[model samples]
Target: MNIGFDGKRAANNLTGLGNYSRSLIAQLAGFFPQNRYFVYTPKIKNHPQINRFLSIPNILTELPNVPGLFWRTSGIKKQLLKDNIDLFHGLSHEIPLGIHKSGIPSVVTIHDLIFLKFPQYFGRIDRFIYNLKFRYACKNSNRIVAISEQTKNDIIEHFNIDPEKIEVIYQSCDDSFKIASTDQLKESVRLKYQLPEKYILNVGTIETRKNLLTLVKALKQINEDHVLVVVGRKTKYADLVNQEIDKLNLRPRIIFLQDIPFNELPSIYQMAAVFVYPSVYEGFGIPVIEALYAHVPVVAATGSCLEEAGGKYSSYVSPFDHNGFAKAINHILDHPKVQKEMIEKGKDYVQRFNTEIISKEMMGLYTDVLKLHRSQHSNDAQLSTRPQRSRRSQRTSKN
Candidate 1:
C-alpha cells in the first residue's frame, strides 16, 4: 500500500506536534517495511526535506515549494493521484480540501479539540478558520485518531462524531527521555545559560495554555529553597510572566532555559527534584511521560487530560487553586515515601506509551481502514455489475 502523510508540522522546532510527527513517522517506517510511506511538506526555511532512513527502503520524503501559493489551487490533488496513494493520513489535522473526492481513504489525527473547548483562548480569525477546517476534517475523514480517550470523548461530545469512527491511539515519548547521566551536558548548559544547581523544571512553550502564571504565583507561595527553571522558546506570554514574577519579586528564583538541546533534555529531567506542569489544557501530556520515564516526581493540573496521563503517579491540583498547588508541591518535597511511590507508579504508567506499542497500534488502524474501504468498494462494484432483466422476459418472469 502507498501511504501519504501531511507532514507540515515536521518543520516546527521542538514543539509537541513536531515531536509527535517525527516519532510516529520514524516508527511507522520501521514497523511497516512492506508498505511505501511518503511524507509531504511545503517548503519553508530549515525544513529537513531529506529522508535519513537508510534502513527503511520504503519511506521517502518530498518537499514542494507551496508556502506562498494557495494550497487548494496548487494542483496538489493531481499530484497525489499521480503518486497512486491508497491512503492519506493528515497528521496535522489539515487535510487538503476535497481529498476524499479522489476516492482515496483519508484519516486524520485530531490530537485535541481544544479550540472548541476553550474558544476564549484563541484569536477570532484563528478560531473561525480552525473550527471550519476541523468540522470538515471530522465529516470527511474515514478514521479520526485521537491521542487519548479523553480526546476521543471530546470529539464525540463537541463535534458529535460517531464513537466508532474515532480511534484512541496514545502518544508515545522518545526513548532518549529516560534517566541518564547529564554530568557532561549539565556543566555546558548551566554555564551557557547561567543556570543554578537545583531547580523544579517545566517543559513546554510559554503560552496562555501552559498556565505558567499560576505556577509562578504558586512558586512564590512555596517555601522550598529551589529555583524554578522553564525550558522552551520565547513567546508573547513570556513578557507577561516576567511582569508577574517582577511584581512578586521572584527574579532570583525564576529562570528560563530557552532552546536547550534535545539530547541534553533527559539530563535536565534527571536533575530536577520535581517537574511541575500546571497546563490548563493538553491533548496528551508528553512531558508527563518523559518525566515519568526519567523517574522525576510530577505535579500537574487536575482540570484536564493530565489526570488521564498522570494516573495515580503524580500529584494534581485544580488550575485555579494557587494554595492547593503550593501544598501539593510541599507535600512532595517533604515526603520521601510519597516520592518513591510516585516514581514507581510513574515508571509503570509510562510503560503504556512505549514506542513499539504505539507504532503497532497505528499499523493496525491503517490495515483496518484499508480492508474496510476495499470491502465497501467491492460491494458497490458488484451491485453496479449485476445483469439487468430483459424486456421480453417480463411475461415469462411473471409466469
Candidate 2:
C-alpha cells in the first residue's frame, strides 16, 4: 500500500496533533514496513526532531512544486496521483479538495468539535470557517477516525455522518513515558526544574478551557504543603490565572513551567506526587494517560471524555467543584493503599493504548476501506463490460 498523509502538523506543530501525526507514521513504518508512506508538507524546517522521520526506509517526504496555499487547496491531488497513493489520511481535521474525484480513498481524523461546543471561546469568522471545512471533510471522506469515543459521538451528533462510518481509536503517550524514571534521574530533573519535594502537576496549554483558575482556587482549600506546578505554553489566560493567584495570596504555592525539553517530561511526571487535570472539555486527555503511564495517580474533572481517558480507577470531581477537587487530591495523597490501587489499575488500562495495539487497529481499518474500494471498482467494471440487449429481449429474459 502506498499510504500518504497531510504532514503539516507533524512537520510544524510540536504538540497534540503533531505528536499524534509523528507517532502514527513512525509506528506504522516500524510495524508494517511493507507499505510505503508519504508525508506531504508545504515547507520543511530545520528542526532535528521532525527531520529524523525522513531516515525511515519506506517513508518519503514530499513538497509542493507550486505555492503552499495552492498545494493545500487543489494541487495536492495532483501530487497524490503522481505518487500513486493508494490511500490518503488527513492527520488533522481535513483532506484536500477534489481528493475524492481523483479516485483515491481517504480518511480524516477529527480530534474534536471544541469550537462548535464552546462557541464563546472562538471568533465568529473562525468558527464559521472551521465548521465549513470540518463538515465538508466529514461528508467527503471514505471513513472517519475519532481519537476517542466521546469525539466519535460528537461527530455523529453534530454532523449527519453514519455511526458505522466512524471508528474510535485512542491515542497513546510517548514511549519514554512508559519507562520508569530512576531515582537519580528524578532528582536531577527536580533540581533542573526547581521542582518542589511534593507538588500537584497540571500539563497542557494555559488557556481558558483548561480551567486553571479553578484548580488554583482548590489549592486554597487544601491544608497540605503540596505546591501546584503548571507546565505548558502560556496564553493570555495565564495573566488571569496569575491575577487569581495574587488575589488569593497563593503566589508562593504556584509554579509555572514552559519550554522544558521533551526528554525531561517523563521524569517530571514520575516525580510528581499527583497529576490533576481540571479541564472543562477535551478531545482526548493525553496527559491523563501520560501520568498513568508514569505510575502517577490521576485526579481529573468530571464531564466530557476525561472519564474514558482517566479510566474508572482514577478519581474524578466536577470541574467547577473547588472543594471536590481539594478533597480528591487530599484523599489520594493521604491514602497509600488507594494510590497504589489507582496506579496498578492505570498501568493495566494504559496497555490498551500501546503503540502495537493502536497500530494494528488502525491498519485493520485501512485494509477494510481498501478492500471495499476494490470490490466496488470490480463490480463497476463488470457492469460496464456486460453486453447491452434490446428492451424487449431483456424484459422477456426477466419474465
Error of 1 at 255 (Å): 0.7
Q: Rate the local accuracy (lDDT) of all candidates.
A: 0.82, 0.91
lDDT at position 68, candidate 2: 61
lDDT of 2 by residue, 1-399 (tens): 999999988888778898889889999999999999999999776676677766778889888867665688689998899899999999899999988888899999999999989999999999998998899899999999999999999999999789999999999877889998889988999998789998999999999999988899999987558999999999999999999999999999988999877778999999888999999999999999999999999999988899999899999999999899999999988888998999999999888889999999999999999999889989999999999899999999999
Candidate 2 minimal-lDDT segment of 10 residues: 45-54
C-alpha TM-score for every candidate: 0.92, 0.97
Candidate 1's C-alpha runs over 4 A off are 44-57, 65-68, 72-74, 390-396
The TM-score of predicted model 2 comes to: 0.97
